[model samples]
Target: MKLVRYRPAAGEAAMPGLIDGAGRLRDLSGHIPDLAGEALGRAAVERLAALDVESLPPVPGQARLAPPVAGTRNFIAVGLNYRDHARETGMAVPAEPVLFSKAAGALAGPYDDVVIPEGATQVDWELELAVVIGERVHRADEAEAARAVAGYCICNDVSERHWQMGGTGQWLKGKSAPTFGPLGPWLVTPDEVGDVSALAMSLTLNGEVMQQSSTAEMIFPPVFLISYISRFMTLEPGDVVTTGTPAGVGMAHGRYLRPGDAMRLDIEGLGHQRQVVR
Candidate 1:
């Protein structure tokens, strides 16, 4: 099931729904009140799928899309989980995942604009696959970790290099800019998404292909990440854990985003994201 959160009109409330085959939003407001709170689980989606599609009221015509996982508690990220990315950044491959947290305020719709912050010159794009956790788990085993996964979505891990690599050295300062985390076109449930580790991903800046690699190239896959990270922190439902990005970032080539630059990110099966640097 492909789920999304959208506001049908300017004043209307953001509602969750399934993206049907014809690409229309089938409203689930009548069925699920708080989507991210409870119905975001894999089981919930499967249950909704079992119901007659024609019964659910569809979101009327055009609605503005929001980040699929709304009111997300924890927006976490893994760094350099892709070997090529670590190589490009001149870092060693980690024996364990290098984890970081992004402010939930950074979350934005898939098509939202990414505003390059003031005094920020080295803004780069890291196209990544973000995992949405299904259940609250702490120090979970591999089997439990796999079962805890709700689904996946596309994420643009936008960074400001000057603050990240320069200054005080907290990557969080470089990340977490408003509108930096462009999340999804849809939150694809696990059953509908096959082989999470082998999915292809790419990022293009202004129609130019810059970053291109598959999850097959990931040094640490999703399952291990969920398990490893959980050992340190409790992952709650609706919290997002974004897996690392592949190589070919703008930082490797000294290419940074400026005003009016357009970036397009694509993750096979997960869908695509478009953002203009503002």
Candidate 2:
């Protein structure tokens, strides 16, 4: 099911809805008591399935979208996990998963404007597969790690090369600008999406393709990534983990985004996103 958070053009309120046949959206929040935990689990989905979608309220075409998940505590990310991306930076392959965090406030809807920090010259885009944890997990094994996953979503790990590499080597400092993390058109559950690694991911700037690669190329796959990160930190419900991006970022080519540029990103099975540079 394509779960979304949206508000009609005439209203500013946000609520959950499920994308239905014929592109119409049906309200899910009122139908499902809880969007988190078991309410989002398989049993709850079965309960939702028995209901008549036509009975639910219809969402307006002019609705403004919000990121699929809200109130998430941590937004964790991996860096240089792709062989090609690592080679582009001339950095050695990482010995372990390179972990980083983006402030929760950095979260923004998929189609929102990506702010070009004033006097910032090295802005770039990294299309990644973001994993949304559904259940609370701590020190989980691979099997448990997979079980803890709620769903998957797409994320543009927007970065500033100058801020990322020019000053401190800390990637978070360069990554955590406001509205930097644009996530979701939907958050799809595992039942709907069969295999995560089989997905293809790509990024286009101003209508030109820049990055294209498969999640199959990822060095640390989602299961391992979840297990690796859980060893040190608890994976709470709604906490997000963005797997690394593939090669062909603008920064690697010394071509950065300008005020009028637009970026469109898609992760197969997950959905697509559009962001305009401002």
Candidate 3:
């Protein structure tokens, strides 16, 4: 099932919904509070799957989408997890997962405008497969970590290279800008996503292809990353871990986003995202 959070209109409450077979949105608000915390767990998803989707009230007209999962407290990410991406930047493949955090406030709906922060010079993009944690776990084994996963979604790991590499060299400075983390058209449960390791993903800037690769290129897959992270910090429900981008970010080519530039990102089975720089 494809789960989503959205507002039917501006200033309205955000509600959870499911995308039925015919591509219509059906309200799931009566069934759950929101797609966060315990609602993200396997048991909750299983219960929701048993619902008769066709009977739910249909949401009319267009709605503004929020990130598929809400109340994300730890917006973590992996860096240099893709071999090709590592090679592109002339860096050696990491011996272990390189982790970082993007402030939860950076999260934005997939189609929301990506505001180029004032004085920003090297704004760039990183298309990544984002994993939403379903249950809290610490020091988990790979199998346990796998079970803790809620599902997957797309994440555009928007960056400001200057803030990331310059200044004091703190990655969070570059990565935590408002609207920097654009995620989800919807979240596809693991069963529906099939093999997570082989999905094709790509990003396009201004109608031109910029980044293209498969999840197969990842050095540390999702489950391992989750497990690795849990050893140090508790993985809470509704937290997101973006698995890192592939080769072809703007900085590598001396290109950067300017006002009005458009970006499109896609990960097979997880749907796509569109953003215009503003």
The candidate scoring highest on lDDT is 3
C-alpha RMSD for every candidate: 1.3, 1.9, 0.6
lDDT for 232 (candidate 1): 92
Tens-digit lDDT string for candidate 3 (107-158): 9999999999999999999999999999998999999999999999999999
Q: Model 1 residue 23 lDDT?
A: 73
Model 2 residue 268 lDDT? 88
Q: Rank candidates, lDDT, best first.
A: 3, 1, 2
Q: Please rank every candidate by TM-score, starting with the best.
A: 3, 1, 2
Candidate 2 deviant stretches above 4 angstroms = 33-46
Per-residue CA lDDT of model 1 for 1-278, tens digit only, reads 88888888876777888888777789888888755866766677678889787777877777888888876889999998998888888999998888999889999989989998888889988899999888887999999998888889999989998988796799899889999899998889888897887888888888889988989889988988999999999998889999988999888899899999999999998888899878
For candidate 2, give the lDDT: 0.84
- Predictions in order: lDDT: 0.87, 0.84, 0.95
Question: TM-score for every candidate vs. truth?
Answer: 0.96, 0.93, 0.99
For model 3, name the residue pairs that clash.
Answer: none
**Which pairs of residues collide in candidate 1?**
none
lDDT of 3 at 165: 96
Q: Which ten residues in a row have the lowest lDDT in candidate 2?
A: 33-42
What local lDDT score does residue 108 receive in model 2, on the 0 to 100 scale?
A: 88
Residue 81, model 3: Cα distance from true site in angstroms:
0.6
